[model samples]
Target chain A: MIKRLTYGLVALLLLAAGPLSHAQETHTLRLAQTWGPNTPILAETVQHMADMAETMSDGRLQIRIDPANKHKAPFGIFDLVRNGQYDMGHTASYYYKGSIPNAMFFTTVPFGMIAPEQYAWFYHGEGMELMRKVYEPFGLLSFPGGNTGNQMGGWFRKEINAVEDLDGLKMRIPGFAGEVMAELGVAVTNIPPGELYTSLERGTIDAVEWVGPALDFNMGFHQIANYYYSGWQEPGAEVQFLISQKSWEKLPPDLQEILRVAMRTAAYDMYIQSTHSSGEAWSRMKDDYPDVTHRTFPAEVIEALRAATDKRLKEVAEGDPLAQEIISSQRNYLKQVRQWTNISDKAYLDSVAGE
Target chain B: MIKRLTYGLVALLLLAAGPLSHAQETHTLRLAQTWGPNTPILAETVQHMADMAETMSDGRLQIRIDPANKHKAPFGIFDLVRNGQYDMGHTASYYYKGSIPNAMFFTTVPFGMIAPEQYAWFYHGEGMELMRKVYEPFGLLSFPGGNTGNQMGGWFRKEINAVEDLDGLKMRIPGFAGEVMAELGVAVTNIPPGELYTSLERGTIDAVEWVGPALDFNMGFHQIANYYYSGWQEPGAEVQFLISQKSWEKLPPDLQEILRVAMRTAAYDMYIQSTHSSGEAWSRMKDDYPDVTHRTFPAEVIEALRAATDKRLKEVAEGDPLAQEIISSQRNYLKQVRQWTNISDKAYLDSVAGE
Candidate 1:
């Protein structure tokens, strides 16, 4: 009788404890990115974001940032995060053109817009509405996580004296630049970021364009390339954080606010860090590789490349539904802004050049 | 005698550790920002950057992200970070017109090149170099960060059916946009971001144009305004991150590399986060405030706004040495690209609008 009564009491206690334990639930977010432990811009910002959440939330919400390889392959980051295998990820929209064609517009467009124009369209114009339509089916929500204020023209083994130099040049490039380059008779290739150095080192690729001096210097581009060209092909490549819909939906309003704050902070600080590091790297490269050639693209060549980029971007925007919405809104804004820039941006440049 | 000898040995060990403990490598970074926690974009990014250095280096490189108030105020973030009071910060170049009026070119120009064009000039053209020259005197480095893609025209108590609505109206604006609005006969007020909300809410301002639907929704502008319009004043407002020279010099080469990678990751991710959040926020906003009326600026108003923006930008760029350099390099590339975008961007947009 005593044993039976003890068992009954224990069962009751267990049932009572289950509700209490369930009520005090904790959440874990795993954010993935396609970079090594040392990549400064995105990786460092992510780590900082995770730490801030943990500290500010008082450990109630724990976020673990799984660097490029820890969780899965680098390219798989967006899919993994989107499919709910991971809670979140860091990526550039152009990286996944095959899966999400419309994403390219958000990441970048050839001759479409710069950082400010892109930000304005998405943040203020109808651009964001189109973004959700693209992401909704995939179960992801996106945000502006990083910006490489207009990028470099790229690194080249030979001087780009004319549009002819681009012909048959095997260049390591990404996103719309590759499409634009391909359209212009250049052999454009996508180099998963990690391999940019080895490929450049082995001459597997004759030319490449990465972020800028800051990223280029750290990646040791100066060690291999005899020349470091400007990155003009796709100015202002925007990067993003892809968060899982399931994870996003689960967060309380306050946690969501915290995430927004954390992401923005990461965005601002990372920009400074890159600019600082890139500038130093530039100085260091000059000091170390005194023979490294630095030259701007000829005016004619710049015009040709820009034309080709625009031509290719139009091909995609007109055909794709999501791209149509985003590109149209952005392009309208761009055209309107362009007329004014003819005076502001162009007139100023002319004045400076004359000086 | 034995106890005294043991005590002596322990005391000797303790005394020897004193200097080592007190002077433990001594690495601390000052990260400054022109924002408070309430302004999540850059402030949060700054916080993450600091946390990353600490975590990655295992506290060898300690970085503290200081809010604007911690220093003299928001406007001083650039100077303070430059002066080395703080190692790094996120700020808009236009905020401190007094310190380096030319720095405004680095942030943005009214009617300056679109996103891609602006980026091209800065990244590929000599824009970055010129910007560095301007900021270097102040001992700072600036990184391109969050861009408010085409900003919304603005929120007003009344709809902007014509340009006359702007006449004598007090508008909360800054940078090149404010100048353009002034030219358009609007009474423009340059209020720091912190004070914008109260100024607009209390009727100190007649109309206000901030980022867009995403940020605008959170800002609760719908409660006070009946009409929301398109982005006209600022096509793109590019923000930047600044770092101190002294703080950057102290890092080892390897840590420097990490910083670069971190910045790249952070900027890209922030861009994605902001864009995605804005989209979701815009869609969900109606559910929060059904009365939020979204209206496009009339064609005449847009044309006038564009004309005025262009005029003001030209005046500034033509007169300013740094602005001219940025405008020249930026527009040179943009001219080439804009031709192609004519068919590519504009044609597609025309088709979409027609459809």
Candidate 2:
């Protein structure tokens, strides 16, 4: 069976060789993402764009995706596309905040817009336009890639029983969570794996807030910590598609359209996914960890958190006018997305949690 | 200038709106990875994939990459892709040895082929086909990724000045390197990030090979350890892209063509990226730690090390016929690529390292 598969692959590869440059001449492009198939919000939607572009162009233009990290790393992707390393990249704009602080707003915030809110902000508000401005400096262009509806509070250890627990409590956090945690008196640490386990076992850190359980299970974090928290810190975290300016400019107009629609699809799917699988992972954990307690922060802690989050956000915006503009736009959008979520998301979670 | 960049971004978004989906049709695809933009391997490649898919299909095919821990943690990446949670993912084939022993043949070995040769084996040999077969059981399709060129033996607190030093030393390691370390009489500890520093600081681990200087510099390994070593245990480490079978079938034929070519481009670019930056990072480290010492394992140690590496390779082939098939094909292709490199890479490194 292995041999047969190998032979088939070889044939596929050989057959692949003939269409290389010819496809390029016809403006047919393929984008390879080095990530999980499910992470994108509307992955299927992106795929549809390719079909649309081809039909619209009457088969003159083509776009397809190799979802596997068949080619590059998620972060290195933007530069690759920019340098013509590859034609384009899908990434989190927030990750590039080191280079462009403003780009973070486009993706999500510690206390920013939820999915519907973020989408509205980007579309109707000036969010998308401002985001593009952030990209041009890097010779890149971008669009919203993925979004989780409203996330959990984050996995925790001991209990965040009080705001005092955060003090000197080393936690694995990223982006705005790290910022907000500082306000709450947490010693925020960015501990990538290959190092996380040793630290926790040896008492190097107290806690970490990674994604929902569909992800946490494999990380084997449950083995180390006695507690796992929700994704509350990042209520709605969005991913992004980073496109190289040179590459984006090279594409004919119709090809660009295909790319946009595809992103929208990924966004919608991602929201639906986080809602479904995250619950399953959490349920599994509950059964697995009879001794491990899962508790929501007290209403007081939550209220305090909300206040701290707002303060840190203000500080970030104060750094520049554009950031201020983004913050205001985000607030307006979230105010709207939350109303719908109260019925759609909260109702469902309340019904399920009760059961 | 930054303000203007934002303005330019607004313009692009406005232009993008012209070809909007208008609720009629959309294509969104998920691209997932095990790491962030900082991880030269998975991060960079994922971004490129998203771009390729977007541009090729116009706006019809959009790819959104889930960054490290955005949806799941690192180890979960493979399973997520396998179970179809992610449409695509970046995988370290060998990392899944517990589940698929044959998978190791596709990635780095304790003393496996260095980068150029490894690339030759996978691309020109039957290596790619064999790897696909290994992945087929999990409903995954794959593409070659770049190699982490000959890695440093490790960052050591005490030099391996002799074989005696190898005894009783606890080491931080992953993959085949751990296997080799165990065979070498060292106590291999698979400690993740949070624990590494405390371990090293407390003298629990005498040595570790986290990565090259670029990342090591940030981790501040220099503050704890004094010696930096050569690249031998992992001559060239390979990382790969994984896609769901269902997702792969969803692409149109022309888009598939685009994916194949784009992967080749991504794989080709990864070579220099994973290595060259290290040189610059090391140079910077020198300024930071002028007293830091650089050394290589002694001649006798290197020979024994090489012997162990060769032994591990033989064991892989002997223990599994599938691995044997892969090795034989990889070796043959390597012999051919070596001919061309003999005048370039081989000759250059041979003369310089010898000095």
Predicted candidate 1 versus true structure: per-residue lDDT over A119-210, tens digit per residue: 65665566667778878888888887766555666778767778887889888876677777887678988787789888978878888877
Off by over 4 Å in 1: A1-25, A189-204, A336-355, B1-355
Model 2, native contacts kept: 0.02
Least accurate stretch of 10 residues (summed lDDT) in model 2 chain A?
A346-355
lDDT of each model, Cα atoms only? 0.64, 0.63
Candidate 2: stretches off by over 4 Å: A1-355, B1-25, B36-41, B349-355
Q: Which tens-of-lDDT digit does each residue in B169-227 have in candidate 2?
A: 88987777777767778899888787888889899888888866645767788877888
TM-score of chain B of each: 0.81, 0.85
